[model samples]
Target: MPLLRARPALLYAAVSLACPEGALADEREEVRTVLFGSLDAGRSTFVSAGAKVAPGGIGRDGFVTLATLGYGLRPERDWWGDPRGKAGLTPPRTLRHTVQAGAVAGWQWVRDWGVAALFAGPEIAFEVLDSPGTRKLPTPRIGARVQGELWARPTETTLLTTTLIAGTARWSAWGRVSWGIRVPEWSAAYLGPEAALYADRTGYRKWSLGLHATDFAIARLSFRVSAGWVYEEQIRRPGAYGTLTAWLPL
Candidate 1:
């Protein structure tokens, strides 16, 4: 997917205009850990765990870092085979394994009303095909990503967020806007619409509507459930997927 390539000057200008004075005073360092999983028909099962740390503390005004590792199990038919028929017929329903590692470094600014973050990083991925008579070598790819996020609270009970992500390996651009309603006891519900454009070996465009609910009943822990339907064009395949995630502060 193509990475979001908006000029950095514009992003900085937007942040300066939207944030108020109070946002800069209280910065502290923190850590967040997340575990998430998703499954889609005819696709694959995906699972990952990651952590983000602000070593200088939240209000310190420095760089934050993130690291994550993930694995995927895909159906055998999804594997690529030799086109000359020299590899013989394709194997039965087998499974392919993919492993990925990613890292990010970004600066964040916090204001009383909201926060803005900008980051750019590189990712490395490897895939292992498991088919009969196929070599077991891992295929590797390297890519870069640029992302930005903004959160604004226009009222005590309402919050708005926007996110943009772009990547070179897959050549895709994605953007999302969401509104959340904060209830008592730190619980919230949010609804968002997202759009993505991908240009790769097989190109496609996708639009999705998603809903998320979160509960912070336990100290330092949060649980979330989200679901969405994706309408895809180009290849003409539509799909739905749901995810469950847990957030822990460590």
Candidate 2:
């Protein structure tokens, strides 16, 4: 059980360390909006929506802007009781509800590189072990990202780009890289691999690898699909899943 619990914490920690420094970039002000949803093999579902509008890049030559907002909902429950069969063991674990809201902003030096700062408020709602009422516990989040483009090749209007990011969130640092395959059929793909360290005070680590696909159907609309795997080092519990994200550009 200790091994199973340690994995997620480590992955979350690594995610915190993979973003770039946005306060000091070179670019004009820009705004980006994103929304994502996911479900696991265990039937757990999660949803999130966020928007960011930056007014100016950090410095005079910065090419990116800074702005932020975020919200999320997720519920988790343990249907199977503890398998340990140890003394003083409790009954089944009830469902846990989580609501989160936050703000973040970042600047970019180019299309593929920049930095950002994230602030979040996460609330954990749960009922007393034996009681029926609910209680909400709020937690704070602070994140920093240092990201840059590692490779890019452009021929006329055709281009292929890859970017690397290291971000710090709470007490963990995460590393991720995104690959964009352009030209050919106007399609893009992203694969992100992340490792989390020192997550939730557990000495364990988690590894998560994800893939995303984007198809450009029109000038203003796109279709996206994604899949990923989450593995815990200590336990045999590994999560595998896929998802879809639709984007309409304004």
Clash counts for the predictions, in order? 16, 33
Leading candidate by lDDT: 1
lDDT (tens digit, per residue) of candidate 2 on 1-250: 3222211111111112111111121121222322222232222333444333323422222332212232322222232334433444443434434333333333333323222233232222222222133344434544554433322223222223333333344233333444433333333322333222212222334455676543433444344445677664433367764544443321
Over 172-191, each residue of candidate 1 has an lDDT whose tens digit, in order, gives 56676666565544333333
After superposition on all C-alphas, the RMSD of every candidate to the true structure, in Å, is: 8.5, 11.3
Q: lDDT per model, in order?
A: 0.51, 0.32
TM-score of each: 0.66, 0.48
Give residue 208's lDDT in candidate 2 (0 to 100): 57
Q: Deviation in angstroms for 139 in model 2?
A: 8.2
RMSD of 1: 8.5
lDDT at 89, model 1: 61
